[model samples]
Target: MKSSFTFVCCMILFSALIKSQTSLYMPLDIKKAYANGTRNYDGTPGKNYWQNSADYKISAQIFPKEKLLKGSETITYFNNSPDTLNYLVFRLYQNIYQFGAPREFGINKKDLHDGIKIHRIKLNEAEF
Candidate 1:
């Protein structure tokens, strides 16, 4: 009974994987770039290369005894290219202590605590 159930589960999972591959979405810009010959076959940058960058100012305090961390940050963003960015991403390193976050190497133990408490974010001295 156990072996039969496992075999059925595997068959269902395989079918799902095959169906998902065909349903994946490719954005319009990528398709247009390929049609216009701006996108190379090997996926390297073409003749017109562009990138975006930002500058960050951060102030933080940590309390080891209370196991607390507090911080504030400001970002100055530069978008030289015509590409529109709907969102920005930031990473908090203190949250790495969590139980199940992926790690490249092995770890001996994990701790549970209030993950990276960010108090405030401001842009041009206006609270965000």
Candidate 2:
């Protein structure tokens, strides 16, 4: 009985694997990564795979009674790729509430305000 049950389970799993492989799709960029030896055909990281990393030091203060919050962050990013980077893109999710900003969900009138205020930004000890 145990052997029969195990065989049935294995058959089901094998069928599922075959079905999934038939529907597998690889985007152009992912295909490029495979060609570049950054990823293997078996969906594993290849020996040449590399990923960028960053370390952040952040400080914040909250004024509970005034319902205000302030924060600052210092990020040290390391570029592990062979190519030199000209610029970096950062996402500010809260900016979705900013005036004239596009949003998928509706926002209450009273809840809407200036999304984020950037006090200062310095890179490599030089202000931009």
Per-candidate local distance difference test: 0.74, 0.87
Q: Which residue pairs clash within candidate 1?
A: none
Q: What's the CA error at residue 31 for candidate 1, in Å? A: 17
Each candidate structure's count of clashing pairs: 0, 0
TM-score of every model?
Answer: 0.44, 0.63
Query: What 10-residue stretch in candidate 1 is worst by lDDT?
Result: 110-119
Give per-residue CA lDDT, model 1, range 2-119, as digits (tens): 9999999999999999877665577999877777666765797765656778888889899989877677666789987778877667776856766676767665563655466556
Model 2 residue runs over 4 Å out of place are 1-35, 40-44, 99-105
Task: State in Å the error of residue 96, model 2.
Answer: 1.8
Error of model 1, residue 2, in angstroms: 79
* Candidate 1 stretches greater than 4 Å from native: 1-47, 92-110, 121-128
